[model samples]
Target chain A: MSYPRLLRRTLLYIGATAFALWVLIPIFLIAISSFTPPNEIYAWPKPIIPSRFSLDTMRFFLNSYGVLNSLRNSILVALLTLAFTLAVGAPAGYAVARFSFRGREAFRLGILITRMFPTALLAVPLAVTFIKWGLYDTLIGVALIHTAMALPFAVIITTGIFMGVPKDLEEAAMTLGCSRFGAFVRVALPLALPGLAAAAMFTFVISWNEVFAATILTVNNRTLPAHILTTIQASPLYFRFAGGFFMTIPALFFMFFIRRYLFHMWGGATAER
Target chain B: MAAEIRLEKVRKTFGKVVAVKDMDLLVEPGEFLVLLGPSGCGKTTTLRCIAGLERVDHGRVYIGGRDVTELPPSKRGIAMVFQSYAVFPHMTVAQNIGFGLRMRRAPKNEIKKAVQEVARLLQIDELLDRYPSQLSGGQRQRVAVARALVMRPEVLLMDEPLSNLDALLRLQMRAELKKLHREVGTTTVYVTHDQIEALSLGDRIAVMREGEIMQLDAPNEVYDMPANVFVGGFIGTPPMNFLRAEVRKEDGGVYLAVGDFSVEVHKEWQEKLEGMVGKKVVLGIRAENIEVRPTPEGGALPARVVVSEPLGAQQLLTVQVGKDVLKVATSTELSATPGQTIGLVLTKAKIRLFDEESGEALKFD
Candidate 1:
């Protein structure tokens, strides 16, 4: 094309490549180091590319004490968090999207305001309350905290999802022999499925990766991240890399499976037709 | 099964803005009643109220003699065609049309038969397997109509259903809707701001203004005998011209005195004008009712043509009479050009007088 257009295109490519490398390079290093043998992991001026690869580090990390139990706990907690967030947040989102009520704006702001408090600030008080309620050191206790952490995002995402579904479709269903609740269940829910999937993925990933609340909430029923955090500093270099790489796997697979839905959500519900 | 709908003392408001003020209306069974008004005049709100979509603040809604004010829309035995033609984008045409039947838990074979029958009626049978996104605007509209019609509801509510279509398609669909109504004979309440649609489709038109029905009558009567200034002005294209005049008893005859000229009141209206003497009134006349001639004829008021537009079959002439500009629809054969002095005669029986202050029509036997 013209000179300025060619210069602009080259600059855009450079910026995009730089951003991609910024995110991918760290993940790449951890992944390669996790596969590297323990002897080569901490070589002087560490190798940019691993010359030898083995599964010994991964095997050792997987077989370590409490690693398998903590993996199970992590999956259970993430699933529970997904269920709790969707159950609570979807309806709240639908309400915020559909209804015009007193203090609606304030209510929405209040939901977001919960996120402003750092986990560090809430952990000690939450631990005391959990002990009184008999939820201390339990997987349910950790999952509940994760739900609290992820719920704000869930509500905000689902509000946009439900808003994207036209109010007329629900009204049409109501007039077509469906009650208001029935209309919501049959029409609005189905139309909002893809976006809801995207929201669920976010909840799953957030619970999967969260460490701070998991560490504070439970001891014996430690999730993957909490287990990794406690052992990684004392563990060998290869074990630390393996632990980091293992924690990233479930979240990566979750993103991969629902990548299409994420695109659908970002493209928006109105883009359907 | 056709059903009657009645609203009594219905009043609805949003926050502080009143959408439908205190109102009462009755629709005879199987009749097409059109609620015609400008936007925000509450025509759509009234339709929603009848459909149980909006609960009335202070009224009872009766559908087929059952007080359905507290009922949800599903229990109201009504179907509504939204202006957006809200056929579910995710569902194929068959599924969309069968949705209501499925909701009612109808038998599968029965739902299929009903859907196919309605699809054939709407002539969208071939597109039944296709999704809404695959259909044209007109086709999607037909699918929406079929979906509503297949429900066989007691009352069908349509809210500006044809407003989204192009002009030519709107006219075509308008005719189809009329034919469909004839065949179905469902009691229909349609809302639209298009005066032509109301005139052509409604069995009786309710002309509304400021959340109140100004007139409710047969289309011809609404056009011919508007109840007030708003109805008169709102109902017609090149709307009714209004002139300020005074009721004067001169030369033993009752005359409506214009700025410098006067038209004699008919003998039948003389008694009515006698009491209205010395009172100011507004005279309403349609554009087609006035006759224009090149020469000053007997009993013809003097006028000058300011602008003449040749509209193929007829010429629309903007003529000046005193301080007022009048739009006249006359024969294209008349070669009346701009700045030409012309004589105008207002048909005696066609003249309508309204109270200046209240804008209410002055009726006479």
Candidate 2:
């Protein structure tokens, strides 16, 4: 390689590494703080590397009032929200992708319009409706709202995935002795599996980290994010740090679970024969 | 099991577009019937209608002796090979070929045996464990054919299966497909836009235009005696040439008159075309049928050569006769040049006359 080209390539690597560190450093500091002793975390001009590691701060956060129950509530709500979003959104996505019916554009526009409204805008009316339906302070009510919030994105993502799969595969399957539904199950569903997994992971993350609707819809069944927000000001910095770190653990696990599909979904690598 | 297929008064429309209009067709048991036409001529639509991928608006479909118009594809007992070769990308070759048997809930051992048998028959047994992504285009197409054939359907439909390959591979697959069809004999209905493919593979060709069949006959009959002007113009390399003329009665016999030149009608056609006297008709003749001579002969039209293209075994001579330019295939050894005068005679070959306005053959069959 020529001198200038080699120098330019080396410079590019340095820039990329610096940018990666810039984004990762804050998350690393929070993670370390979650395991530091309370006194160590409070030291003036705190050491860059922790003097020692301790799980006492994490235990304190877990034992706090309603924290463990809220942790259970968060997990349950995220799973339920993921289920609801897929059940309602996947069929809608398929319909939009495969058909050219009247009002299709209008229906897509309607879904887009729902996303334009901030969650706070619907909180008051939804709260009243939940109380009237006797669903107040329940995990199901919050899950319903979270599902509504995540559904638009899920529908759009799944629509793109289903469109990428060729319709010829389904028609071939049907002609090879499969019914229309059977063709979908045997061909289309398997081809779109990676995209569906990515959509489900995204929904789980949205519901897991959501605070506004969860706080408004329930009191005793507050999700972890809502619980952390409610107790942040009253608690010490170490408790706040541990609570935030605990809230992030599920998102990390969800990413790890769907890592195989993540590159394909985001990079648009068709990998078709 | 081979079975005759029938479509009666099949009409299909998409919104306001009439794709197949009032069509009726029949395929004799184990006969290879090809639907040939240009794109958007409803040939593929007709094949899909037979496959039950598209429901007819007002027609009944029959396979064997059973009316399968309302039956779903699964119960209708037919298999199809798609033009795109839609093999399941996630499955291995063995699994793809065995999918139909698995769907029917056959015993696991039976499915495996059937898959192995089909792979060996297609000479793809060594590739059974490989996914579709690992195969070449021709290999993928073979896998698709194996998948369709393993079902042992009563009928098999192919929609331009060889149109996707390169020219060399297409020729190879075309011969293999013909051999397979002869051995299996499953009453095939193939569709293609290439006339060569239709002529080489079809026992009978159905040429379609504007949602209707223009001619349904054997390959040579359609080539030599096209039913109408469209079929004449649509088939053959460099297509058949056409000239505007009128039938005239000069002394008791009939002759076709064109600008200052005429050819007496043959005795066999004189009676059939007697009613066409004084009527404007379009005469159709193939390029190879016209004979070019160096000197004027009896009843030969004099013309100027516009271009001479030598193509090894024969030469294509474009000659201008009066106001029309006609392509004549002649011997490559016959020396000719642009602006040179030549004598063109078409009396010895078959002639087709069509009603110029309606574009239909003039004589009743």
Candidate 3:
């Protein structure tokens, strides 16, 4: 290879690495500060690397009023939201992908338009309806609202996923003695699994990190993100940083669980066995 | 024993576009019927209707002795191999072949045995454990065929299954498919736009055009005696030459006049053209049947050679005959050059006549 081309490629890699660090530095700072001892968090000329590591902030956050309850509530709400979003959105995606119906495009556009509406605009009306339905301050109510928030994107994402699955496989299944429903179960569903997993991961992260509707719809059953927002201003800097890290940890793990599927869904459609 | 398939007056329409119009076809038991046509000619639609993959707007589909028009694909007792090799990418080949058995909840041993037998028959036993992505195109297609064959369906349908293969592989698989059909003897319906594939694989060929069957007959009969100008032009390479001619009654005998070259109509067509004395008709003659000679002979039409294409065993010569260029297939060694005048003799009995208005074949008595 020519020295100029090799030198140019090296410069390109250096530029990309610099940009990556620029984006990731704040997240890394937050991570390190979450593990730093409370006394060392705000030390003068703050240490680029803390001399000591401790879990005192995490322990304090976990022991705070309703913190553990909210943590449990957040996990429950995210799971329920994932289930509800998939239940309401996956079949809609399948229908939009596979069939030509009157108003199919209109239906898709209508669903996507819901995402343009401010969540805060719907929060008050949804809160009022939940109160009237005797679902106020319940995890189910909060999960339902999160499902409403995530469903539009979920439907759009899943539609693309199902569209990636070829119709030929389903027809092949049917001709091989499977009923229409059987074909879906045996062929299309399995091929669409990676996309479905990615969509589920997206819903779980959205519900886990959501705050406005969670705070509006629930008071006693506030999710972890809602609880942190209500109390973070009053907490110490170290405690606040620990709370942020705690809420982010689950999302990180969620991404980790579906990282392979995300790669498979987007690239390497068929890897050598 | 194999079952017969019958489609009675099937009509299918997609919105305002008619895909199949009042199509009727019958496939006898154990016979290979090929639906041959160009793309969008409704041949695949008819096959899909038989498989219950499509619903006919008005018609009945029967397999064996049972009406299967209202049945789902699984209940229709038929299997289909798609043009794209549709073997499941997620499953191993053995699982793909055994999927039908598993769907029917057959015993595990039975499913394994059937899958093994089919894999062996297709010479893909070693590939049974490999996923579709790991196999080559031909292997994947064999796995698809095995998957359908293991079902032991009453009728088997294939939609241009060999079109995806390369030319040499297509020829090899064509012979293999013929051998497999002979061994299994399942009533088969195949669809292809390639006339060569149709002629070689089909027991009977149904030539379709614009959502209608133009002719349904034995392959040799369809090739030797095309039902219309379309079939004649579509079935052969370097297609048939169509010349417009006027039928005239001269000296109490009918003769076809072709720009200063008039030939008496054969005695076989004498009765058929009795009432059509002054009518314009299209004369259809295949390239292979047009005999070209270097020497100008009596009763021959003189023409100039435009170009010659050597095709190994034979040469296809384009000759100019009174401002119309016609393709003539001659022996490769028959030496001829461009701008050279040659005498062409179109055999009388081999000439076909078509109605200029309707493009329908005019019968000869």
Candidate 4:
């Protein structure tokens, strides 16, 4: 085509490539640090090339302060958040997509409004409630708070997903032999499954990385991120690096696992307006 | 093998906007019934109401003579193929076809046999394991049909199913679909805005307008005798022309006078125009019925050829008669140029008279 048009395309491609590298460098650095010698973690130029590596730092972080249990706690909370989000949020999402009620618009606005509040504001009050309810230091209690935190977003995202599944397809299912609920479960649900998986991934990451509520609500049930925050204060510098490495590795891997979905959700955001 | 479907006095509305109003129709068993209309003419809404996709505000819906107005769609044993094809993107052709059976918790072997049977019937066995995204548009349409057929639904409702296909594919699918219906003998309600498709495919065509059916009749009869000006004008491509005219008595013969030109009313329509010989009326003549002449005769009118559109095998010519433009389809491939002057005669046999005030076609009785 025209020279200016070709030049613009090249520049856009290069700019996107540069942005991806810029975002990944920090993550890459933390991962490499896990292999650096403990003493050289203190050295200048920051051990870009480690002469020797050891599993010592990683092993140490894993065994140090119930870090394993913290990881276990993190998985449990993420899964529980997923379960609660899907169970409660799916029906609510279906309702918003299929029916009109008196306060439907207001309810949608209210869901969005919940996302605007800072999660930190709930820490103290939630802590008091959890202690009073005898759930102060349990993984179950921790998961409940995280679920509450992720619930609104789950509802909003799944609602959009269900809306994308053609309303006619569900009705078609009904005439072929599905009850109203059965059609949702049979036709609509399967069609929206990919979107639901993305919603679950989002809620999982939110629960996994949540530190404020996890820190306020528990001592014994400290999640992975909360445990990392505590470990960084007193641990050796390399141990801190190792802990950060473990957390980012899964986060990076999981993000990559659902990169296609993330692109769609992100693209969907930009495309709508 | 197909179910009879009937909608008696069915009405549906969303707030103040009525989507369907007092719709009453019958689709005979094993018959292909086409709902023909423009977008938002309540054809799709009527299909959804029959499918229970939309609840009726008033009246009843029946399938195979059973009241299913309030029954959930699934229990009514009707299958619908959507305008978009609606093949499950994540599932393979086999899985998509197997879905309804799977929902019923049919035994594994039975589901397999049903899927295979439908796959063969639709000639999509080669695509059984391929996902919808992998299939071409025509193949996906076939898979959707296979999916609905696998359910063995008593009635098949297709909502503009072929509207998304390419022109050639649409024609191909139309033929194959007709053949499949012949073999399967399923009563089908097919909706389309393309009157060509409706006329060609529907055993009986229902021409609808503004949430109400203007006429429901056999394709040939409807085309030959439209109930009103809207049906007369909307049913044909290149449409029928309306010449503003007045009924006048001259030499004891009734005739319509349009501007400086007049066409003698045939003896057959003389009595039809008896009321107020000076009253206004509209004369509707289909394009193909406008005969071109080399020289102006007593009944011939002068016209200027303005535009010529070459439709394969025939050329569509637009002629301006006085202030009115009329389309004429001619099989003679003689290249005609715009700005050419010619004389055209409106054949007496093809003239349809309508009351200009009410738009209703006039009958002698």
Name model 3 segments beyond 4 Å from true: A1-22, A253-273, B295-297
* Model 3: per-residue Cα lDDT over B181-237, one tens digit each: 999999999999999999999999999998999999998889878999899989988
TM-score of every candidate relative to the true structure: 0.94, 0.92, 0.94, 0.90
User: Which one wins on DockQ?
Assistant: 1
Query: Can you write out model 3's per-residue Cα lDDT over A1-273, one digit (the tens) per residue?
Result: 799999999999999999989967866888899888888888999998889788887788788898999999999999999999999889988888898899987887788688798987787888889999999999999998899989987887777778778899999888877888889988999999978988899899999999999998888898998999998888889878888888777677877776655554333222311
Residue A182 error for model 3, in Å? 1.3
Cα lDDT tens digits for candidate 1, A76-161: 99999999999999998898889989997887778889989999988899999999999999988888999999998788778878
The residue pairs in collision within model 1 are none
Residue B71 lDDT in model 3?
93
- The digit string of per-residue lDDT tens for model 1 on B69-147 reads 9999999999999999999999999999999999999999999999999999999999999999999999999999999
Clash totals, every prediction: 0, 0, 0, 5
Candidate 4 DockQ, CA atoms: 0.58
The digit string of per-residue lDDT tens for model 2 on B1-365 reads: 89999999999999998999899999999999999999999999999999998999998999997999998888888999999999999899999999888888999999999989888888999999999999999999999999999999899999999999999999999999999999998999999999999999999999999899999999999898888889988999878888888988888888898778887667878877788778998888899888889866776788899999999999999988888888999999899999999998885447788888988877744
Error of 1 at A130 (Å): 1.6
Off by over 4 Å in 1: A1-16, A44-47, A253-273, B295-299, B304-306, B335-340
For model 4 the local lDDT of residue A191 reads: 84
The model with the greater lDDT, 1 or 2, is 1
Top candidate, metric lDDT: 1
